[model samples]
Target: MTAGSNSISPIPVAPVGLSSRAQRFVEVDGIRVPRQDFRRHRDGWIERGIPVAEIDRAADFQDRWGGLALPPAPFYEGGPRILNAGCPKGSGAEGWSFPAGAGRVSMPYGFMIGPDGAFGIDAHRWTPLHAGTDGWVESLALAAHATRWARTVTRIRGRAVTSLDLGGYEPVPEVQGVTDTWWRGEDSLIALYRGEAVGLDAPQCLEAHVYEGLDEWGLHGG
Candidate 1:
């Protein structure tokens, strides 16, 4: 059955108001289900090493407290893939509050959407490294890569960033009329890539910036 079906197969879950159509909406796509429902479904596709929703309850962790004073300690990356990881909390309806609900996982790095890894974030936006090439094709390509990075990041907090230009030894085409606008929203950061904002492609070494630095462009290859 479609994921939005309220009738959970194993057992009845607390009232999940999402209709099948609503489940497919952009808004509900990243929400965190109650802690219990997450567990039952996690095992459904474990053979592929997919993580179950076993995370520290959102009520347990505070928001991005300590601001920059802290080490942006909400995320971690690179090794020891834990499929049954926690949810990513910061902003959004899923954040603990009046809507006191579950939507965050204690994932230090962040989250990947599909079990197959079609799209996701690893904490790096490349505005700082694409200098001199402004209004250029390489710049737009980089913009696409970075915007994709921001949208994919599960947690809004910051994370360690590492970039390497894997698209090497090959010639490429350049596209004009591409630009991006990186902004900080009341709750979440926003990227207007593609039409206005964009990101860099794979393998290009880039830098990570805090929300404060989103607007400024760093030198192209520092």
Candidate 2:
């Protein structure tokens, strides 16, 4: 589905759970179905060691959670994987939208699709050691990587954020044509580029701002 399309599956009626390893599973009626084991790939994760029972479980899970089934090859590089959810709240009914609903399994980094259709991540838990620097450079690298991957999977181009409405934003002078904006949290920062904005917890990021809606960008990494 495109960025604003309602082609998203409705929230599942069954109980959804995330494993300690960040695996998303389903518990319906009374049966508990676990997700396949994930192995680390080049800066990403791929499912492996899936048992036959898990296949049956996946089928059942799909049946319960709108007819949306998991991808034949469940590979998550970054960003929130859209499995069975609706368009994000507030976005119009026209284009493809990343509606926040059930069946979204975010990476350990807390990448999620905000209600406004902007791609976001909860980097509040990250530390400077994650990138071996003070984290400003690391945050930019992560934002770029996540944006590229999010575009690849969802076909939804992220809206570039050119400026910020509050403080704590530092421009990346090296990367021309893209102005980055960040909202400082207690420990970390939530970032975006021109034409982008955070959805929930606006106060945590910015107290006052305008919502220009989500805009499309050219193919990232192009």
Against the reference, the lDDT scores of all candidates come to 0.25, 0.28
TM-score of every candidate relative to the true structure:
0.17, 0.19
Tens-digit lDDT track of model 1 for 201-222: 4332223332222232221111
User: Which stretches in model 2 have alpha-carbon errors above 4 Å?
Assistant: 1-92, 98-118, 121-170, 173-198, 205-222
Cα lDDT tens digits, model 2, 41-121, are: 212211433333333333332333323333221112322233333212222333222222232453333433332223334
